[model samples]
Target: MVANFETVTSGVNLNQYAGRLEQLGPALDGIGAYAERQVKLAIAQGRKLSGERLAPLSPNTVAEKRRSRKARGILRRDGGLLASIQFQRTRANEVQVGSNLKYAPWVILGTRPYKIRPKRKPTLRFYTADGWRSATEINHPGLPERNIFEGAEKAIGPFATATIAAHLEGDL
Candidate 1:
């Protein structure tokens, strides 16, 4: 079933492609860390991976930010969430980049109007534009979808692909 190579002037070594595929091992190993970095960079730049500017913080949130000196920068309160953004190797060739914070979902995916009430207490006390107030329940307007996790796919997708391609081609 094979053609005669004796008549051919140039040599054909199809095995080269198989060897190139070996480069994927290293590329896969580093992809997780690379993706985490891109996500953090996008946050610092205050932009989405698609080059769109991130939505501004809510007005009440902004006021809260101003009130607390510990809150520095957008979505950075005490730097906990930002520092929590990391890469975890779930499998030999698989990795996940995200935060373990409970509110990460709320940050990426906007919530609908909901009621917030005291769980351990008889009532709730919070400050408002008018001043401090006491209530049994409060209606939260909810937040907008930041879609920060979208950074991983949009920013790292092509970069990782190109890196693996370059490595496979021996051009990395």
Candidate 2:
């Protein structure tokens, strides 16, 4: 008996998966388009609401005033409009949200196409000497009602703020 060994790397050759890859494009595109449309709508809604609220502050001012306005929460609190834009950008960059079966070809068949599923419960797990341990688990207080993207989008607004604050505070 002879034992043969060869180095095996983990990856799907896009060329090898071309057929499946082609099947995935339309679905990936659809998800992407849906996300893009939702993000655009979210930003537009934010802008419209903010614009309506700040309608009284019309009339362009000098650069200094503009800077002051930003500081004073005139244009958008902590660049909220820009924050909203960045929120979309963040989601766009998020592996869980932005990723699709196209890049993760195996997920399509092995999993359910990687669509974001609403999380009813989110638990943090840790390794212990005895076994796996779960820390305080907070069930999605808004679960069984909202889809994952909606939940993510809603949560991201505050999470992003907290994240920035944490970074600035050197907590992260």
Candidate 3:
């Protein structure tokens, strides 16, 4: 038998896998949206993506929130942080979910103990168990680590498998 075959260097087909591979980009897009929704949902419920309940708000915090007309939920105030959650698609299979809000890190890792004083006013006025009080300066205990966003990021690991499988199957 005599045969002639031209050397091929491109347009290689991945056979049956090509179709699924093509679906990956769209899959990642969906995954990012899905992940963002999951994180926001977890936060709205005042829990971590791991289903861990967030730390309870201090009495002072609750009282102040009520008086200031802010949402009285843990890790929630005026809904800015929740609305700021975002996801960026960086590659065919990679997406990054994060926030541009400056205080997001503080929500994730908390803060060190510090003094809180009025910058413009002579004293700080806030509510407490004993009712309204005024102070020139107050020692604030460091906030407890919420880590809700981090927990959601971690939980997405398991979700990635399911999401990809669903995407490939056109079920996502």
Best prediction by lDDT: 3
RMSD values, in order shown: 10.0, 23.0, 11.0
lDDT of 3 by residue, 14-122 (tens): 4644577665776777677878888788879998878899888888888788888888778789898889887777655567776778888887678899999999999
Each prediction's number of clashing residue pairs: 0, 0, 0
lDDT of 2 by residue, 101-167 (tens): 1422221112232223335546555433344556554232221111113333443334443443343
Tell me which of candidates 1 and 2 scores higher on TM-score.
Answer: 1
- Can you tell me which runs of candidate 2 are displaced by over 4 Å? 1-22, 47-67, 71-172
For model 2, what is the alpha-carbon lDDT of residue 149?
34
lDDT of 2: 0.33
Which sequence of candidate numbers ranks them by TM-score, best first? 3, 1, 2
Q: Model 1 over residues 69-167: C-alpha lDDT tens digits?
A: 556456667776677788765544456777888887777677898999999999998765455689999999887777766545556677666766576
Clash pairs for candidate 2: none
RMSD (Cα, Å) of model 3 = 11.0
